[model samples]
Target: METKNMEVIYQKVANILVEMIPEEWEKILLYAEVREGFSQIYFYYYPINQKQPVYSLDIVDVFNIDKTLHRKLKQELYECFEKLWNEFKVQSQEQLASLTYILDNMGRMKLNYGYEDISEISSEEKQDKWEAEYLV
Candidate 1:
């Protein structure tokens, strides 16, 4: 696919995120970009009044996907989004905790991406390492 089309795809991905989780749409999406020849899909989220994204993930090895898998990817992602949204919805906190989902499969990525308390963003590692790698 063309590079500009990749941007459009990322935009569509971002839009799907907003559509999936309307309540926290703004916080749910910061940007999407196809990098390294589409081998990676970067998903970013910036919280309100925050300069940086609280969480992120990079879906690894996305390039060279078969057309059938590519189509299925979107549907599978929507299903994941819905389930994660439900998880977010049921939390008892008055304010939603800083939430992040890695939702990764099919390739290796460094970020855990598994569901966890967003507040527990580690102090062990520098924030910059965490800043990269958004879940897509």
Candidate 2:
């Protein structure tokens, strides 16, 4: 997957988040994955502060994004995957794209935490570790 597309998606999401998140939310981690034609396109957000354990919530509710905006974001996700398929298919001898293109990028302003592949670490474990290291 192209890093540019990921950056764009992150930026769009962050722009909306900036207006909605409370001042207490020191940082927010976004986990997005697209597997099997948007069937697994789950967007889970973990809002963190130094005083509390990291917790997950659906971003739409967390940010109070309405259905129209949610649908637009979902469409953007699908478009991104389509772009990936188009780019990858040409590079393959079989002329078929891989089904394992999942986007799980995490960024919060100047702080960026690298995520392990899905097979390596679960999102809950990452939240636990973050809480242990950063929270009171």
Worst 10 residues of 2 by lDDT: 96-105
Q: Cα lDDT of model 1 overall? A: 0.36
Q: How far in Å is the alpha carbon of 135 misplaced in model 2?
A: 15
Output the number of the TM-score-best candidate: 2
Worst 10 residues of 1 by lDDT: 31-40
- Give the Cα lDDT of each candidate: 0.36, 0.43
What lDDT score is found at residue 46 in candidate 1? Answer: 46
Tens digits of per-residue lDDT for model 1, 60-123? 2322434455446556554433443334345532322223333222211221222333333444
Q: Would you estimate the TM-scores of all the predictions?
A: 0.27, 0.40
Per-residue accuracy of model 2 over 1-136 as CA lDDT, tens digit each: 3356545644665554544343345455433333335322332233443544233334445455566765665666556545544444444523222132212224434323333334345656744554464444
Candidate 2 Cα deviation (angstroms), residue 119: 15
